[model samples]
Target chain A: MLPFARVTVIGLGLIGSSILRATRSAMPTVRLTGYDVDPEVRGIADRIGLADDIADSAGAAVIDADLVILCVPVGAMGAVAAALADDLPADAIVSDVGGSKESVIAALRSALPEATIVPGHPVAGTEFSGPEAGFATLFRGRWCILTPDDATPEAATVRVRDFWEKLGANVETMTARHHDLVLAVTSHVPHLIAYSIVGTASDLEDVTQSEVIKYSAGGFRDFTRIAASDPTMWRDVFLNNREAVLEILQRLTEDVTMLQRAIRWGDGDALLDLFTRTRAIRRSIVEQGQDDAAPDFGRAHE
Target chain B: MLPFARVTVIGLGLIGSSILRATRSAMPTVRLTGYDVDPEVRGIADRIGLADDIADSAGAAVIDADLVILCVPVGAMGAVAAALADDLPADAIVSDVGGSKESVIAALRSALPEATIVPGHPVAGTEFSGPEAGFATLFRGRWCILTPDDATPEAATVRVRDFWEKLGANVETMTARHHDLVLAVTSHVPHLIAYSIVGTASDLEDVTQSEVIKYSAGGFRDFTRIAASDPTMWRDVFLNNREAVLEILQRLTEDVTMLQRAIRWGDGDALLDLFTRTRAIRRSIVEQGQDDAAPDFGRAHE
Candidate 1:
């Protein structure tokens, strides 16, 4: 049986639009509705027939949805949830696709206290945003983390889990607090470092911007891809997951300082030791099927 | 006419084997020879027929070559060059594929004063190393920067440039000092940061290594791909390009500090501005053909 007969997705950006497409492809009989804060996105969704119905307003979209997912940024989850609170079906299960779980769970629960809230984060995305950048296969073989507290109903969590599994995600259950910390190290801090390094490269007086762009294949190109992620979404992630991100950043900075001192003192062994250890982690990641085993992350060469 | 009819590669690693393969494909009639200090690598290269002849020693490899490209780590370039100095052909042009040019040029010139020295760095590589991991297309459409000082012969410089072009690389000339500085920003520091972050992630007491590997798709996988690079090569790069790399690291640290404060104070505006600016740089890199326009760097998903 399908997890939800009527599903509504708010915020028709990459993740939300991808959900619509994936749901349609996987369970065609299920009804779908979509809405976006941006009118232009809504118009595009309508033109492309992204859903069974393109709701003009948030309230209209979730009026009858058995499952209403807040696909908006973490900071905007409260406002988006509150907008549809009165219109949402009495038996609906509310979920979200936020990078950080604690803040989202808090915001979502506060907005809809009577709702069955089961927050999730699908650990998948590209460097692109907007409705047109998503595809049905985006979630295939990726992890979808469900951060449901003890108070959450078992049936509600199971339905949410099944829905993500139908969309080709490997679902795992965890606490909201742990999810935030794990994601902080794995996603948020990595992105912050990428953005900081890219900015550092661009601001250099010694190196021309053209030179940086031309020679990016050396390694800088990888940072640019992550840094190119949606600004508003990432800003919300940092703001909401502040403590965890700051703690991870502090750890990263200490490591960087140690390496910096090693470089200054010409300590080749210390550098090599760390470099060697990191290589093993890459192997573990590839072996776990989290990434491809192809060289250079399987970057296409033309 | 080919740039060099008889070319010897003195290091049967990724870059050397790739040069041999690309040379065989592009100029089938040219004679190629290869050598490595490790007998096991030599045995593998011989078993795979990586070159027409796998010399037993570095001195034997360059005996009759018109051009010899040293593909050893920067730290070993001096020793490799010294080993071949007496056996090198009187008119042979010596070159290298080192990440940093200045130290390599100095080492080669000091070791073989009378030899025609032209150092080049192909701004291309995958995390995989060794002869068997290489492919002929690694250098296709990639930039090869040649560092030939004023004292180097014009004929020698042109011949080296033409050789790289025949191997499907776009060649450019620059001073060795400037090349070191630019690469310090683009390649060296990026690698250092990647290594540092990966090290930090692995060392976290609260997060298990398995957790880091499983959730790597969140963004940590990108850094791992770079941190998995050859330790010896990267060690040599950091040690030899000390000044420039340290300078860039200092700049990157300052930028990270600024962003840290922004996140701590909940300054979303500052964070958004930097994230937005970085996206433009990614677009520029893609437009300039330095990286593919495909989302997520066109990483193979399966």
Candidate 2:
């Protein structure tokens, strides 16, 4: 069954356009309206026929939307939500695709006090950004986490869950705070570390940039893939999820320090134990169908 | 012309068996001898025709070989080299595929003072190990670094270079010390950080194991691929290249600390600048043909 007859997507970038494409493929009968703060993106969305109606403004997009999804950066969620406040239907259920949930939920509640708000984060994306970078299958078999609090209506939560499920995601629910913490560990900290390592490699005096790029396939290339993600989005994620990200970063730094000491002292046993233990987790991820079991992450060698 | 008429590989793991397969494909006339410490590996090598002959022992494998390549973990290089010392031909050119070149070169030189030693590391491998995990094209378009000192013969170094080139690798030469430092930055430290992060994620009490596995596609899955590399090999790499790895690790830790402070202080501009700068390096890597430019590292999503 269709979750909503009229759906509006604000910020028609990767996540927003992806939702439009997936909805078009999955629920062809539902009416779709889309808008982006950038006129260039709006023109591209129109050229691509991304929605049934490409609205001129956020307020125009959500005029009678039964469901309104904000797909802007976490830091921009509040401003974007406020843009549509006066025009949103009283019965509209608002949600967002932000990496951090707590800040987004608070900002959205502040902007649309009388409307139902349920923040969501789909645990799927490529390193690419913008409307053209998205595809329909990006969220297939991936998890979409819904951070809905007790104040949220049960029917609204169920509708959101049903919507994500219809789009080929396995939906799970948790508190906004818990969602922030889990994503901080699983996503934010890893990206921060990847960015740091790539920056370090580029700044090395002895190792030329060309040399680093040449021999990157050795191991550094994997980090570069994650580091190549959208900068503005990541900056907002770290800023909005500061406390949780910092806490996890602290734990990661301590773990790295322990390994550093082991290498300095030639503690082979400690190194081997940790290395062996980590391998099991990779196996579990593959077994759960969360990752490809093929060697080298299923990369084709030529 | 083929580098050598008779070539012996003293270990039948991923690197060793790849050499055997690549040699077979590139130089069909070359007589290949293979041996492994594990009887099961030798049996598998024989069953799979990994070499012209699967020798019963390392000593027997190099008895008449003109070129002998030791493909073993960095920690086992010394013992493996010593095992074939007495039986090695007087004019044999000795080389090894150890990640840490300095120690492997020193160990090979000490174990066979009269023989020519040109230690090399083919900067190519999958996370998988064992004879069954090898392919002829594993080294295709990858860098193969040879660390040959002034005391080493130029002819021997050229011969090793030619062998790798024939196997579809781009070969380069440098000092053993410089090779260790460069690889520590490019490969060793990356692996250590990857292992540490995976370990950290698994040990977190607030996030359950199932949660980590389910949501790993966010960013953690990239680290898991590198962490899933052979434990014994990585353990040996860290121990053998202690000085270089430690130096690089220190730099990485400092970089991480800087980012950590940015996150803690909500310095979104600082975070955005670093993230933006890192994306250029990824672009350079892809432009150099060192990595795929496809979205999500060319991961197949079904």
Candidate 3:
């Protein structure tokens, strides 16, 4: 059964485009309409036949929709929500796929005070961006966390949950603040570290940029994949999840300091102890099907 | 033509076994022999017929070999070299695949002062270890850096370069100290950061370990692959390459601090700029064929 019959996706980027494609594949009878502020992206969506209709504006997009899912950056969520507030149907349920839930939920609530809002975060994406890079299976086997405050109606949250499950996501419910903290640890800080290290490698005096790129297969290349993720999306994530991100970064920095001391003292046992313990986490990630078990990310060597 | 008629490999771990497998495929007619300190590993090599002959001892392995490659950890190179010295042929050239070149070169020189020493570090590996985890194509299209000192004969360096080239690697020569610093930026320091962060995440009091593992697909999992690398090998690398790794790590920490400040102050422009700059490097890595261009390292999404 289709949980959402007439859905409006109000951002035609990677996540939004993926939702359109996934909906088309999963529930063909449901009417899908896509809208984007960028004319170029809208053109691409239209050219690609992304949905049943391409709306000229956000308000027009949701005029007749029963569900509206905003796929914009966390920092822009409020503005987008406010822009579409006037024309949104009175009974339509609003949702989002922002990375940070607390800020997103707050922004969404302030913009659409009377609407039934369910903020969600699909913990899945690639380093690539834009409409062309997304695929229908992007959310398959991935987790989607939804944050709905006490004021949100239970029926609206369930419908949103059912909608995601139709698109192959495993849905879980949590408070916005807790969701933000969890995502800050799992996503934001790791991206910040990746972006920071890549910058460090490129700006080195002793190591030529050419040399760094050449021998990157040694280890630096792994960071590059995550570092290459969409800049605006990541920037908003850090800004919106500021407190939790900073807390985790501080913890990581202290841990790194301890390791620096271990290296300086030539304490092989200390270094070995940490290194050995980390292997168990990696094994669990693979065993749980969160990652590929094949060596080197299953990259082709030949 | 084969670079060496008889090649001896000591240490039947991932790199050593991979060397045996790659050599067998690249130079089918060359005589091959392997040895390891662990009798169990030697037995595994013999049962698998990893080489033409699996020597029972280090001395016996290199007695008639024209080329003896020490495929052991950096800290063990000196003692292994001392063990094989008495039986090594007078003209045999000694080389090593240790990650740190300068310390390894110094260790080999003190143990076998008159031997021709060519230190090498391959810019390729997987998280998996042990002989059974290796494959013949592990070195294909990878970089193998050789650090041979002025005192070493050019012919010895050339022969080692030729050997790696025949095994489908691109060979580059540089001074041992320079190689150490370059690798500190490219490999060693990157590894230290990965190990440190994984330790940090696993030790967090508020975030459950199970939650971290489940949400790892959000980027935490990327760090785990490198963190899971062989602990003994990495411990020796950080210990022996102490100066270079420490220098690069300090630089990375400073860069990370800058990112932390940007986040603290909500400097979206600065964060976005660094994130954008990093994407260019990832592009360069892909353009140079250093990494797979496919999104998410070409992982299977479904």
Candidate 4:
């Protein structure tokens, strides 16, 4: 009853390796193959036996794959698709775990004309990257957004959805443009802001970097965990999802400016009102099982 | 030898109740008392036996205590001290757990001119507020900073330091001004930005609030934990530490603007450089034991 009896994962990074592990754990009878652009990564995958086969090249990896998931950076999706185009099976259902979908979908369509494409983005990750940092449980209980265009066949989308559901993800479908905007607010810009603030904290002349690290438990440490996200993946995300990310970042800047004014003018009520309102969102996020209800994200105090 | 034989914590909120619980756990024989202006909080504390006594008034809370720690909002520290001034035992040392030290020191000095004072800030907390949310291990492995001015007796500072150490905190001494500046980057402004961004995300017209909550796991949830901090406490912090918070905020805004420009102009290299550099800070935080080394803050996936 496997949706993908023979699966191939390209760009064997965190998400790719994770899909391999999850498939191995969930549908062991199904064949799993993985490939990375870096030979070192492929060697590591081989050493770990991450899949039934760690293919030497993209073309060989997808030649027999019923389902092919491109797990490289969004900016590299087209190139990866192009690399495997001639060898890919005509009947193969192609999907991806890219953050930004509009650009990725366009790139993929250009490289794989007439291919069944259903791009997806799983809303879960640790800051760590590379093959070793992934886990079988990463996609469990998390949302995996699938962006399937008009040209994509319903059967292909359903197979991709089933593939994710079998791996333990809740699937939702949306247009690539809407997906980009929603993710811009929730994921892409949040990472960008986290990165920007950490950079700002480190560059401060008055507050030594040591002090920032020591006292980070107050709030900055929460950001450091996020600011530590993979650089190449995130850089490509910003570049690919430019319009939506810029739009959300502009709104955030405006809101922050309003807060700055409130702080400068000693408007405690304005500050308190906004702070109080935001708490309810956190409550809803927890109540909806999107985040841990445990205090401090369940951080151990002792 | 115990540094404090009798401790009174006025303001039965998260930090205040936590101090009482930590004291009971670490120094069982010490006399403890607590008070809050909110009758409901005081009743909850009394019902739970949070301390040896739940005083009805701030004045009655510290009448015979050898140490009094005001754990209310920074803006209320002066009022709490003035309320307890007439009944405060002459030999008692007063301290506070305020985010901004310089203003609190001024307020306490003005309210209790003849009293020995040591101002402290515990760089630790959960997003939850009020008595029932506190626990004995709240301060374990966190930093407690004491800012005692030249006019304050050294013995008073030492006694406060010893008290925090007994509660399993590492104590450090610094000037109140320096403490404010340090926390501005590490804590205050970080909290402000978190609160601001959460507000921004919730107000997005294109994206439904429900969508934001469901996809929050990506990175926004990391911010919600911080944004969920007590409004009254954070409001007072920003107002009291305006100068330092504003200075740090300006730097963060400028850095974010640079990032926006980079993203808009497709400067992936610039974004990658900053994102890569920020990862080192996250590593140092883990190495220093300032934050959990667990990936995704050790959030459970299944």
Best candidate, lDDT-wise?
4
- Which regions in candidate 2 have their CA more than 4 angstroms from the true location? none
TM-score of every model? Answer: 0.99, 0.99, 0.99, 0.99
Question: Chain A in model 2: its TM-score?
Answer: 0.99
Interface Cα RMSD, each model? 1.0, 0.8, 0.7, 0.7
| Clashes found in each candidate (C-alpha, N, C closer than 3 A) | 0, 0, 0, 0
For candidate 4, give the lDDT.
0.93
Quality of candidate 1 docking, DockQ: 0.81
In angstroms, give how far residue B257 of model 1 lies from its true place.
Answer: 0.4
Task: Give per-residue CA lDDT, model 1, range A59-122, as digits (tens).
Answer: 9999999999889989999999999988988899999999988888888888899999999999
Interface RMSD in angstroms for candidate 2:
0.8
Which stretches of candidate 3 lie above 4 Å from their native place? none
Candidate 3, clashing residue pairs?
A: none
Model 1 chain A is weakest, by summed lDDT over 10 consecutive residues, at: A293-302
Ranking by lDDT: 4, 1, 3, 2
| Top of the candidates by DockQ | 4
Give lDDT tens digits, candidate 3, residues B1-302.
Answer: 77899999999899999999999999999999999999999889999989999988899999999999999989999999999999989999998899999899889999999888888988899999998988999898889999877888999999999999999999998898989999998889888989988888888888889888888889988989999999999999999999999998899899989888998998899999999999999999999888999899988889
Model 1 chain B: ten consecutive residues of lowest lDDT = B293-302
What's the distance in Å from true for residue A211, model 4? 0.5
**Each candidate: RMSD:** 1.0, 0.9, 0.8, 0.9
lDDT of 3 by residue, A1-302 (tens): 77889999999888999999999999999999999999999999999999999999999999999999999998999999999999999999999999998888888889999998988989999999998887999999889999998988999999999999999998889888888888888888889989998999999887899999999999989999999999999999999999999999999999999989999999899999999999999999999888999999998898
